[model samples]
Target chain A: MRHDVILRVIAKLLIPFILLFALYVQFHGDFGPGGGFQAGVILAAAVIFYGLIYGLADARKLVPEAVVESMMAIGVLIYGGVGVAGLLLGGNYLDYFVLDPNPVHGQHRGIFWVEVGVAVTVSGVMLKIFYMFADRGRVDE
Target chain B: MAVTVLVIARSRNLFGVIVLGGLYSFLMATVLVAMDAVDVAMTEASVGAGISTVLLLGALYLCKSEETRPVQAPWLPLVVSLAVGAVLAYGTLGLPEFSDPKAPIHTHVVPRYLTELKQEVDVPNVVTAVLASYRGYDTLGETTVVFTAGAGVIALLRRRRKDRKP
Candidate 1:
């Protein structure tokens, strides 16, 4: 495989900012037009762009398949865990207000955690799909 | 638009159809965005322009893409589709006008979403709040649907560990 110096530099430069922006969007969701879903997609798109310019193998090396799989599971677990937290706090499922003494702050905290779950799951799912499709040739072998 | 669709349908070359399909989807996405439905536009542009085009091309690799005349239209499919479309349009009549403040959708639940959304979910984008919290159950189901589709595709493509069955 031929290495494109420009693409490599671009990936190096953009990836950190992409990740930072994703976090910013995730956290600042309450104050802005961005949120978990958009952040997830943008984050995944950055990784996808890297995989496209580089190779899938390189992308996988950076983010291993096992890690991706575990993340997928962990995301769901986090989401479900929040509901359980609410239940334990004497509220119905996913009742964020009951999760803490201060209802407003509790809502904020719950949404933040939920957004994290969403970001992880979305990025994991998208990467999985990209890998499956790009790995089509290997499967045929 | 009709001309574009006809040309796409009539194209003999597979590549031409693929390009045309992308163009069609691009145009549709632009229209959606122009109409202020940015979310729908983003989805259409991504899935339709990006993924659908790739999937179609990939499928084309697995089969011949030469266009052949349809022998016959299934009368049942045609009737069912038209009937369903008519019913859907009829249902739309009762729906609130687009962006109308007085519409029930805009008046009640929608207003609450637009107004109290930030205070509750703390998200400025009410759509995201609605998708992730207000109606999160539905979003969870949607996420599961994506996961299910991925699993289904993986299962379909996976090979047995050993070739020998006996």
Candidate 2:
């Protein structure tokens, strides 16, 4: 792993752009061809790329296993919470029209938050799968 | 595409198979884009070419690179698959033509989405509007599935790690 100077350097340079692209896809889903699923995978790919070059242990240090586990639940909660918020706001379950003063803005706000939740959960799922598989032999008895 | 699948079928090396699978996924994504299913294409690209390839590579590390020969002949499974394919093909004969405006699928909800989507959601991408707002419940279900998969993986692997005695 240490001998591949080019791989490490190239990965370091590309990771930020990959992450930025993921964010762009997430926000631009309404107008373009991406959303939580694609953004989440891209985000996970960035982390996986980092792990491939710098080692999984370093990657885990940056996004701890426990934290990743928590994120899985947190994202789901965020998504469901929005629905619950809508319910509390006098709308039907998961309804976004009653979210704000204007139905249109509320729809936008609802979609944004829901996509954010999806991104978080998706990225968390991907990272969790990677961690489990990568750590299979390394996690010692 | 056919050539890649043939190569994948012939290859015994898991690594090569995974790489070819990623290539196949990339091709499928392109096909989806050509069909104007950009959102689905994006998902296929990310999930198929990106994460699954890496996951397969990770799994490959814990297993043998080359596949072992199977004891049974492939003829029976091949025949069964061909039979199923024939049945599916026959079934398709009763369905509507591709992009037919009169198709039941196009007639029901498609027209509504096409007509009122802009006025209702006002989003340019109707796919987003449908997934995030119009059919929000389905999206919620999908998010829950992803969350559940993550939780299941953690429970299976991380718990085993903790159980290992020092």
Candidate 3:
């Protein structure tokens, strides 16, 4: 379904702001209500909105299925790899204090990385699910 | 179905229903955050508002858009749902207040986490520390669930490409 020209333009204008807000939610997570997962979903929703108003083909052009699959794996790997890094340093799994001698910095770094991993996994999953249903719905139609 | 009930109760068209459902899920997520159950809220809001609704509308393509005139009244399901709702509400009445500083949840292993969490995990947000470190295995299982879901989606949406490769 092609959106009207005005609505499409409005969507285009709004997309960037939505994305910015998601990013803001992500970074401000420590003090605020949102964190990686919520931010990731909100980000994906903006992309999904783009997909909805424009054609799914255009959305796929921007975010391919293969990319989403890789992102899913990378997210887990990132999370686990951080833990493994701690293990290799003679600490137990996911013990990020050993990442650096300074505990505060270590916590900061670890949380950032973990949140990145979460964000990647979640956004990828959202897009992947969208493709699945949207594709199936198209075939059914 | 749930959508019909929502529409009937809320007085909205299908598009409005979808948007309202999203809003409702988000509000529920907010409640979860207020309870400091960030993980559950994240999953609920994402899966409920983001994916499930899309999937429902997609499935709707295979079926009727408008509700069919009921051949029989849905009194049984209605009663069952109401009973379940009442039971859930009643259950909540016995629970401790949200964010109660004096709640048993705050007095138990949580204090230990607040004290030694930095020494052990170096994460400021105690929730992440517990989720990823204190209970790392559970986080791994959760990740596995995501992987399994990805696999399920792949299997469900598989397409046969018949041009000689396999």
Candidate 4:
């Protein structure tokens, strides 16, 4: 793969667009057909594409294992924290109505954060699984 | 789609099987889209087709490329699968027609979601509104599940520096 010029060039051109599309799916989900789960998978797919073209080592360098691990936990925390925030605001658990003075605005805010949390964890888990599978049978440098 | 499955079933090469599996997923995604489940279609396309194929290939890299012949007769498993498929097909006979407006799904909670979505969540996509706001707890649970899966993989597959052979 490292020696394949055509694959390398094409991948280099495509990775950024793939990433951009993932972000589009993530943010535009509120209006369109995509959401955090789809966006997360697309994001991980971009990195995985990079890994396939370049190398696992390069992909690991791009998104470090520690960072991936932390992302997995941090996303869950973010989601749970939203619920806790709602509870603290004198609303039921996972309630979005009290997050802001305007209930509709609070709903938007809550959904946004929740989707972000979902995207983070999903991407992390996907990358982590890819890393684990690709790492197998490799010798230590 | 049926041809793809047949080819996959006949193929002994694991690589071809994985690629065909991706094809099946893509086809499934298309079917989902035809049924107007765009979000689910997107997910199926990305996860089932894209990532799962890559993961299967990665796993294949660590093992044999060709599948070995089964030691026992395949007839029993074949019978079981056919029976299950028949049962599933029979079950689908009881389902409402495609896009039936008066279907239970459309008449039940969907009406409320469709009517109140703008006022309640105010998102253009009802699916997103439902998943993130109306069923926030479920989404939270799903995120936690993903995290737990990642943790479990790390536990099983990660090799520490000290554990490596010198």
Candidate 5:
């Protein structure tokens, strides 16, 4: 795959843009059609493209399976934590209005954090699945 | 989409089936966009067309490119599927027309979601406002589902790697 110069070069060129687009989608989700789930998939797709062009071992170096595994848990924790925070703040579970002094800003803050959690969890899930499928039954060279 | 499905049903080549599956996803996205479900369309295009194709290709790498012919025609399963499809079609017959203001869904709290979008959520995108805030729990559940799916894949596949290793 590395010797495939065109693919490697093009992948080198495109991976960054794909990740940047993922970030844009993640943050701009509130204003547009994209969201955490879409952003996460795009991000994983970028990394998977890197794996396809370089190698699974190299891609693992960039995003170790350990980290990917943690991400799967961490994202859920973040979302759940936000809800717990809402409870601590004297609102009902997942009630965003208590997040900030200003009710509207509180809503924004709540949504932002949850969306980030979703993004992280989704990306971790995608990457984990991709790595699992890609790494299986490898015939060592 | 129907035609593509028919072709996919007829094709025994797993590779062609996967390619057509990707095409079907893209077409589904187009149909979603036409129905003004841009968010769903974006999701379908990215996940269905993009990630799913890559996944199927990886699966194909591990399996034969051609599907093995069954020992006998799966008549029982075929009959079950057709029956299920007919029941589903019948279920939809009583549903209200799309985007009809008089529909039960439209008559619900949608008015609040639309009217208070700017003031409540402060986001112009109603879908985002609704999903992230109003319906946050549902999205949380969806993320959990993705997480569980990944965990399941790891559990199933990683065992093979561990067994193979010295």
Candidate 6:
């Protein structure tokens, strides 16, 4: 794949747009069809595309195994932390109404953070799975 | 779609089977879009067709590319699958027609979601509002489930340094 000039060139051209689309899906989800899950998968797909064309070692360097592992946990923590924040604000668990003076603004704030958490965890899990499978194949060879 | 499934079932080449499975998922995603579930269609396209195909190919790389013929007729499994399919089809007959306005789903919480989403959540996408705000706990649980699944896979498949033979 590395030696395939056309593939390498096309991949370099496409990867940046794919990454941008993922970000758009993540942040614009509240106004559009996509959300965290779709955004996360799209983001992972971009990296996996890079891995497929540039070699797994290079992809791993771009997003290290340790960083990927922590992403999985950190996302859940962010989500949980938002809920705790809601509780500390004297609201019920997972309540969005009390996050701010304006209830609607609070809802927006809460949803945004929660979606971000979901995107992070989902992408991490996806990359970790990809790396594990690719690594096993390398070990076998 | 049925023809694709039949071909996938009959094909011995695992690579073709994996590709056909992705085709099936793409077709399913199209059907979801027709049903107006764009969000689910996106997920089915990416996760089902895109990621799963790559993962299956990776697994195939580590194993045989061709499936061995069964020693005997697989009659029991065939009958069980047919029975389950029949039962599912029968169950669908009891449900309302597609996009029925008076359907339970449309008449239930959907009305409230549609009417109040703009004022309450202030989000244009009702689905996002419902998923992230109205059903926040469920999403939290789902996130935990994804995390748990990743942990489980890492536990089962990851190799330790000392365990790797030189």
List model 2 lDDT by residue over A22-114, tens digit each: 999999999988888789889988998888789888999989988888878888888999999999999999899899888988999899889
> What digit string (tens of lDDT, one per residue) describes model 5 on residues B1-166?
9999999998999999999999999999999999999989988999999899999998888887987788888899999999999999999999998777899998789988889788877988888888889998998888888888888888888775577778
For each candidate, report its DockQ versus the true two-chain complex. Answer: 0.36, 0.82, 0.39, 0.84, 0.79, 0.88
Count of clashing pairs, candidate 5? 0
Q: Worst ten-residue run, lDDT, model 2 chain B?
A: B157-166
lDDT of 3 by residue, B56-83 (tens): 6776665656654667877998899999
Clashing pairs in 3: none
Q: True contacts preserved, each candidate?
A: 0.26, 0.84, 0.33, 0.91, 0.86, 0.90
Model 2 DockQ class: high
Question: fnat, candidate 5?
Answer: 0.86
What residue runs in model 4 are displaced by over 4 Å at the alpha carbon?
B159-162
Give the Cα error of residue A103 in candidate 5, in Å. 0.7
**lDDT: worst 10-residue window of model 6 chain B:** B157-166
Docking category of candidate 1: acceptable
Clashing pairs in 4: none
- List, residue by residue over B57-136, the lDDT tens digit for candidate 4: 98888888999988897899999999999999999999999878898987988889999988888899999999999888
- True-structure Cα RMSD, model 4: 1.8
For model 2, the superposed segments whose C-alpha errors exceed 4 Å read: none
lDDT of 2 by residue, B112-158 (tens): 98898776778888888888898889999989988877778778877
Instruction: State the TM-score of the second chain for every model.
Output: 0.77, 0.94, 0.70, 0.90, 0.90, 0.91
Q: How accurate is candidate 6 locally (lDDT)?
A: 0.94
CAPRI quality of model 4: high
State in Å the error of residue B124, model 4: 0.6
In model 1 chain A, the worst 10-residue window by lDDT is A132-141
Which residues of candidate 5, in runs, are more than 4 Å off? A139-141, B73-80
